[model samples]
Target chain A: MDQALDLSGNKMTDLGNGHAVIEYGSPWGRPIARWVPSWGEEKREVIERMRKHLVQRFGEDRGLRMAENSRNMIIFPNLVINDIMAITIRTFQPEAADRMTVNAWALGSRDEDPDLRKLRLFNFLEFLGPGGFATPDDQEALENCQRGYRNAREAAWNDISKGMPRVGPPKNDDEEQMRCFWREWRRRMSAAA
Target chain B: MNADAHLARAATASGQCTRAQVEEFLYEEAALLDEWRVEDWFAMFAEGATYEVPPTGDGDELDPAKSLFYIADDYVRLRERVARLLKKDAHSEYPRSRLRHIVSNVRITGFAAGIADVTCNFITYRTKRGVVDTYYGQHFYRIDCSVSPWKIKSKRSVLDMDQLYAGKLTIII
Candidate 1:
């Protein structure tokens, strides 16, 4: 527990570079089977807050993954918050869940282009000036960012559809949602390029 | 030989556990889950047994105290989760998702004393109301053979997705 807590402090601390690595394949490239942890202490407050909210929204299993990487770069396109909403929709309104999974999400308007979508995320994180997402705290910021992030996820996935491994999205119209990290991947490439 | 190989050799050397016996044990467990036999499934674990669903990655060390897990349940919490599932108001499961668990590639990785480590590949297809989602993973079991029909000391399921592809882990994996 202490080791995990300690390593939680070992963050990359460089979203300034605006680059994050997205890894989806097996660590050992095994054609079969997978195992995976808790956050260490450096971001104790942040992690705890994220954990509480996430645990309440999703069940314990899926929620723990988000808290485990609380201070780490947010995994692209798979926001834990969005998952909470999605799961709720799935439970209460299966039709809505289908629509949400189909016609749904992002941090931006559905109309935003890929480039603008990239800029929105870059700005959303720093959230420094007026009109920026200035929440009372990181916890709220984490919660509030879901809708926009979902929108951003949609836009980001759209840009790199060709580069990503093309699996069919849940709905044909929602074909923009790619299978993996490429969801937020090519933005880093294009933003850096 | 590698440590895992050593473990595998040790388990079979006692010759008390056959490959078929292990396979049968797994199938029986799967049937209980398929029937939504939550209490029976819970009963399959030893008193202090754990069910560890780690992050969706490969080969996580899976230390409960140190590593982050998706579902890290001690017996008490595990029972609570099972109880919640049985509740009529549990939305995620009230309508009840139909799940089919396919267990394949069974292997006896390690065994010592009364415990044996078995690994198997799993692909679970969950269908609820009309949406269908498929989850694939590997299960690593630390099983106690001292008991009749054996009991799970620990079950570590590692999913293949970097993110959980399913909306919720409402059902047993």
Candidate 2:
């Protein structure tokens, strides 16, 4: 399920000053229901209801566009706003050389229908939060990378060269976003020194 | 006494499930989890059951629809959760952490219309990769006693800690 949203096809635009946005365009311009065709009838029904609600509330064109597009925006240092199946605003703070605290919140539209709101919250829980299916794996991957860095004395350099030779915009899976963040981080550290 | 004896005694007396029956059920559920019998544990829930865990410090009455929860799985999502965790690719649990679930302070707070509202305090210890983390919480349950083997209609585990120790609730609490 996680791999279906192929980040390799996403388009990343550098927003300058160590910020960037990745636009993950939906396949066939369909809503989430179409993304996972194997979902059971119950799930498909809920998604359809929510999609119809969106169309009714915002009219056809805007609603369809809203359902089809997802964006991840990084704010220079330690904040990310992911407007995906649900809106997630996340930030992290480093406490020590090897420790950091992360916080996340789900954002929803005001006065949303009770049923639709439940669906939104469920979507958020499925992917964004610490207990979610996706984020915990992300945490594990990050922590494993941190552990590997214990050998930094011998492996001093980390690679972020993905898509460095791309002709135009960078893909989401590329290291361009990290490159942006590191560039700004180096600038700040150099200035402080 | 065996499970059937307890249930028979409880049923003959008041036609209602007693605290003993509830405790037995909870203990069995905990055992299934500790033994990593997730599929068996999932079977204890009703078809449309809900499993929720509100953020630490949030009130028990906080509506998951309006507020954020560590987990607020509906029937479909709950099934998906079980399926995901049982897979070899669920990296956080791929090597499956060692877990011990301790359930205490069982109480039958309310009962009506074949439904019983139950509560209990819990402390689950998870050891993984040589690190141990403790998750202590109070669980609020709504069990449907109308069935032979009471099914869980809703289970809400509310943490008492001020914050998650490592900001990760990667284990089922």
Candidate 3:
């Protein structure tokens, strides 16, 4: 995913003090103080079409739900959050790392709930690419939160898997996969040792 | 037989805490949770007992201090959490999602002195806003069998997923 914006056509002019605005050709286009980049006409059209389809399939409420969900990982949810995540990490803000994190968080109770949206920010941090947070403590907190989940969707039976291969030899896909898994497990273990 | 085997057998025989008792206790506890009786569920643990779901980042083990866990709660904290959830404004669970905790594969892996090591498999189905989510996991219990009916000295749940099923982990697994 090309996470960084194409700043080839954009210009950053210093507005005195520590603040500066990123201008995308037009003088009157950007939001007041906040940097919200406008989506190109093509992307906007595509978003509208997807939005309509989702609304029709899942109804109005749910259509909106799906759009709000994964906003961090997917298209820029409007301009503010996109600017925070995509822009701050590249340009460097006063708060730096946590700045974008906090700004992305300050977004809204829009997508999911406020809390779930905040949590999802950390979940989708992978898409943000690598960089340190504002403080070491902040980084540690994010890692701790990420590691807290069991992260299980479907669980494999260790006991049953070990015991219940087919009566015959490896004749089926399941058996083949299991054999492959065991072989790979052994290879990794031996290599590690 | 080794002394450890003898001791294990002796403990099980003396305590008379059969697999059936442990199974029953687990079921009753599940019922309270299904009913959203969080406080009653909290009472199932012994005083000063810990209810833990260890952070199995890539492996299954109980490392309290080093790894971050979904939940590693002492009795006091458990009480506080349950209390908070019971309030009307606990938005995460205010409406309370419907749930069915299907527990199976019960086995008493070991018994020694007052503590019995029992394990079980579970796949709980939760439905909220018409979306059904399945959570599969294993629960390991350290029961204090010294008493007539054993108390859950500690419980550690190992969920199968690397990340939570949904973004939110609102209920007890």
Candidate 4:
């Protein structure tokens, strides 16, 4: 569901940095620039926190558990980032050079919203494209980076499988909920009419 | 008139549309792209057409040498680009895209010897990931003498907005 704005509403200017605030003053007036001094810094910290929490929640033993046929290898590099959810390294056939697939997620928020617990998660599953797997030396390097995640925190999962096969197109669940509300509102209006 | 004027007049003797007609043709072409009619849009270009998207600077006619995205050599490359855009295999268009294109301020910058240079300003509305991304750019088109059929010999999309707002450059600018 796409968000539609009434073009005839208040005068709006696109600041180009994922933000647009409503202006009631003079359309020609130079409004104060919307500033988020702690935006980038806060995001960085939250990412770190999320990483720590995940490790503690999913211990090494349970985190790496998989189905017998999964043929998956998990590398928790010492320099692991919370922003990166999980990276699965797999091989297609015995002779094929090891192929790497990175499963990373970005946590962000909309403007004027500062709910860390309510952060939005965007997932990206990319086949790192033919090279750069965890070599024996690389495997040794990641062992140093596996710290435990902080446990007992709220968490939610969103599947960001846009543009990927068999994974239905990406959708904004919130937007769909909003659409349902509007549909219900219209139905009620017609009933009252 | 000098030798140049005589050559120009001789060239103009062949079939060619007026500036307004050329603009109308381009405008219709833009409409096809905006509506996501991929095959119909491809039919607009001439055989062996050259499409170029130069990495422009503050200056005009950005040097081809610095072009970020260039297809100066062949039409097959353009076809490949359009093919990838339409293909479901391209990860960039997983959800496909909803776009609205606005082309305006078209001007015939030059006309002589049956070769004309055309310019226009445009704005694009690219929507995906629940966001609407805006892009502004100027288009440069050079019609060749061999373009008796009034086909576009060359097309250069010189964008004013450099930041790629969308996830990828899957659609034509």
Candidate 5:
């Protein structure tokens, strides 16, 4: 778990007004090679082609930046934009204290190269979305947590203290991002009260 | 002429595969999935085959390249998916759900050269942990029948539902 979090290289930044951004790219802009072991020659070829296309379409520096880095940003309460291997815009609506519904959409650039677009779509389906390999597990984890919350009255508080003593930026696995959100949430609730 | 007769005529005109043959192939494929013989099912794909499921409510014409899809898998990724599912560690399917695949309304819409364009309706029920999920959809397929046993060149399953019933489609459709 620590290795995975470290590999994600998430650095959190509190963008006042209840918004926050977590920039996630491997340290030094290196590709997360571990994630691509299953990719064959054809898939690697597509990545190379897309890299060239990006470089040609948008100058060298910006194109490399676009191809390399990914970001996960939250807009206040519920909206999140995960611009990772593929871009996904997600929002959740809380229907009750225990139930909520989430809506997610994949975002892609218009007029993208056909092959690259296919790759982007493939990336989106591989990790994000309801049926993806990753999201189902995430949903399961969340549901498990909710089930455990049934005993919250006895268990009381949930811990959100990771990397709290760090002097510098927070790591991906750190709970600082959640703290940021909760801080804003508390401020708003106190104001309303 | 009725639709079946028209389709039969079209199949004969193309002289590639008959409706009965396509139906038999689809039935066999469905049986493999229902029995959880995923590796065998995976073997039925052509070398460069693609399997796709566009998001619910999206029409069949939406190109997976240009739009989002619930599942879009090329040959390599599809292979990986099969391998993952068969593993004992695939938490979502570790015990493997009981599945029943009902395929109907099979038709050979078009055939040319060695490829047959087939369409069918499917309703798959997945039962796990005492919960049942129903997935109904139309399947559009491009089957390459040049070889003795046909291989799937492309299979696109377009779901007819408005939303996922259980908020998650963990099982393969």
Candidate 6:
């Protein structure tokens, strides 16, 4: 707890350059399943679907080869301020033999693009601020931002669409939302670039 | 006049709790959540305490009005949520996701004997299907130590991942 406090303080003190460093330690670390025995017909179906879709969006080897480095970076593009200094992940061969722990350290100058930072901060204050206390008003603003974010996310995915492997298309609203978000995000980034 | 009287009384009442005690209460709650003791976790709340998880977009701190999930003003609603988790029928809890909650930034924004307002920053990691997902949220808890050794009067978990990939919030955030 004290360590977390100290880290937070450091983040606040350093402001833009600071990284919100967090460490979760537990002797109880263990896999939810001792073995993903489900990697059979049913599991294979899901995996194939995931692989095809990922390939279509990201490209080639699907996720078998490049998943480790790209998973976090792809999911959260903003987190990478500078080139990722390092990412270490511990995994077991059988998939569920033991718990896997992933640790990443990023180093970058605090020059968070001003427009990006402004957008981020504005989004934050809008939701967490006292103005959001009004339930209806809060809900409306929240929905609008979500709509924008979904568009941005699909745009992002579309940026890497060329290299993306082909998997099954999104089956539900959540996956569709992500796809749309990345697609729009890519469009905006290209326009700016 | 009624609201004014309530506010005055609340302000006066909140002044009594020591900062350390408030911190301790929060830590205990975190411990319970980390342990995955759902029933015990529910007991931490006051009788009418509400547990809310508001969805914010882009994980941005500025805009909150467009939250995806909003549980407004109901303790029983939270109870129903917990009940669903406890049942075997809840697919979201099926494999029973494992969670590690890291809570920080505990600050006492206000306090009173039977009422207190507090804020905490938390990051939770949930693992399932050989995949790990992360979530960040600020917990807004209203407590009443005077009522019964610090029961939560209300709790709002405002998650940055409002467009959650999962089907439902089976585990307490």
The residue pairs in collision within model 2 are none
**Interface RMSD to the true structure, each candidate:** 16.4, 1.2, 15.6, 17.1, 1.4, 13.2
Q: What's the TM for chain B in candidate 2?
A: 0.90
- Write candidate 3's Cα lDDT for B1-173 as tens digits: 99678657744653666667778988998898889888888877889887766543544575544333456666766676677667755454556779888888777778778677888998888786566767778998888888755578888888887655353455677
The DockQ values of the predictions, listed in order, are 0.01, 0.63, 0.01, 0.01, 0.60, 0.02
Instruction: For residue B42, give model 4's deviation from the true position in Å.
Output: 2.2
Question: Every prediction's TM-score for the first chain?
Answer: 0.20, 0.78, 0.24, 0.18, 0.78, 0.19
Over 4 Å off in model 5, which ranges?
A: A1-10, A27-67, A165-167, A190-193, B7-16
Predicted candidate 6 versus true structure: per-residue lDDT over B11-91, tens digit per residue? 455677655777788778778777767788888877777665654553323222223233333565566656655665554
Task: Give the share of true interchain contacts found in each model.
Answer: 0.00, 0.76, 0.00, 0.00, 0.80, 0.00
Error of 1 at A18 (Å): 27
lDDT of 4 at B45: 72
Tell me how much of the true interface, by contacts, candidate 2 captures: 0.76
Name the 10 consecutive residues with the lowest summed lDDT in model 6 chain A.
A7-16
DockQ of 6: 0.02
lDDT per residue as tens, model 1, A131-191: 1122112322332344445676556433434423535322222223332345246666787
lDDT of 5 by residue, A41-97 (tens): 665765666677777888665565566667788898999998776778999898887
Total residue pair clashes for candidate 5 = 0
Candidate 4 is graded, for docking, as incorrect
DockQ of candidate 3 against the true complex: 0.01
Give one digit per residue, the lDDT tens place, for model 2 in B1-173: 99677546545543477888899999999999999888899999998999998988876999987787998888888888888888988999988999999999887777788998888999999999888999998999999999978899999999998998856777778
Q: Model 1: share of native contacts present?
A: 0.00
Worst 10 residues of 5 chain B by lDDT: B7-16
Model 1 ranges off by over 4 Å: A1-193, B1-11
Over A1-193, each residue of candidate 2 has an lDDT whose tens digit, in order, gives: 2334443336888899999887766543133323345334556776777677777888665555466667788998999998876788989899887898988887876776676676677667777787888888999988889899999999997888998999977888787888999999999999999
TM-score of each: 0.48, 0.84, 0.46, 0.43, 0.81, 0.41
